[model samples]
Target: MDKKKFPVLIKYCFLKGKNTVKAKTWLDAEFPDTARGKSTIKHSYTKLRCGEMNTEGGEHSGRPKEVVTDENIKKIHKMIATECVHHIIDEYLGMRKLCAKWVPHKLTFDQQ
Candidate 1:
């Protein structure tokens, strides 16, 4: 089960007056492979009881966040317009339109 489901289960068990032991047991039965520990259940229960269960996760800061804005979209559009797709493909992928043919010469042991 997902970590998100744990909070919902904890809330349910807490609402049903189930202790940590029973909650852990239920979790074990529900998801035998991923049975949540007592501490995890207790912490979630405490959060639910104390009305601090933030489903979206509490905010924390470290790395700068990146988001696409209208300015970025306009800049991308301008770049695409200035540099057409054919030139970009030819520059990177070496694809070009040409009219030509290969003429094979007679093979000889000396040529090899």
Candidate 2:
């Protein structure tokens, strides 16, 4: 049921000369709940045919995983505290709304 096993099984089927559909059927029979999709089996078969023998996935430029270490968490907390303090100071000093004007929520045509 492990994901890594799927590619290995698919590769075995390919090497055994089983076509994509047959490989999918075999996998379904073996792993009813966690069988890989037909397209996935076919893709793996194609890759095997193209000389990509590695059953594992290749390196891809995906979004980097967020590491939630204590150090990272502390850094994030420090940044958030600094930002909050800055916001509070700016608001108290009236520095954030210097070019603002008050208006009614529902404006009349003349006001607009």
Candidate 3:
């Protein structure tokens, strides 16, 4: 049921002269829960017919596989530190901003 094995088995069925539907059926019977779809079998069968025998996938272009790098962690930590300091300073001054307007940190009940 390995992902790579699906294509290999599909290729085997192709070499045995089985059509796409038959190949899919055989795979489904062998790997009931993990069989590749008809479209996938057909695609692999097409590739086999075209003489591309390598079953493994080639390198593909897409978004990077990793996003949480050390540099990104450092950047986020620095941003949070600066924002925290700014908030502390504002709190100490008993002042806060609301909708771009300077407002007192503590408001009267009527103001609330």
Candidate 4:
């Protein structure tokens, strides 16, 4: 249910002297098969009863920021260049099979 409607529903229930359970029952009956469940109704009731319910939602802690700036780009580019050149030299010069034991497992899998 929309957060905007919570205040109105809570107000109506308040005026009618209905308990949270009664309000929840009415909401479930009215908005059947909805995303809103018992927990949502109960939470709204708790907020309304505690005088914390507001029109605007509170700020939430979301995913952490992962900014890939110019420094990160240059570092990644250098790593890729080094790895590719090493692999190319080993494979083209026929040194890969002889030195296969020395090569890292990750590099072998990547080459394949």
Q: lDDT of each structure?
A: 0.74, 0.80, 0.85, 0.65
lDDT of 2 by residue, 1-112 (tens): 7897888888889989999999989889989999999888878877888999997777879766878789999999988876785566565543343337533445579967
Off by over 4 Å in 4: 1-11, 64-112
Sorted on lDDT, highest at the top, how do the candidates line up?
3, 2, 1, 4
Write candidate 1's Cα lDDT for 73-106 as tens digits: 9999888876996566556655554455322233
lDDT of 3 by residue, 1-112 (tens): 6797787898899999999988888888999999999888888877888999998888999878897899989999988876785676686777787898777888999989
Which scores greater on lDDT, model 1 or model 2? Answer: 2
Clash count in backbone of candidate 1:
0
Compute each candidate's TM-score over C-alphas: 0.48, 0.56, 0.56, 0.43
| Alpha carbon RMSD to native, model 1 | 11.8
Q: Which residues of candidate 3, in runs, are more than 4 Å off? A: 66-112
lDDT of 3 at 51: 90
- Considering only N, C-alpha and C atoms within 3 Å, which residue pairs clash in candidate 1? none
Lowest summed lDDT over 10 consecutive residues: which window, candidate 4? 97-106
- What lDDT would candidate 2 get against the real structure? 0.80
Residue 108 local lDDT, model 2: 73
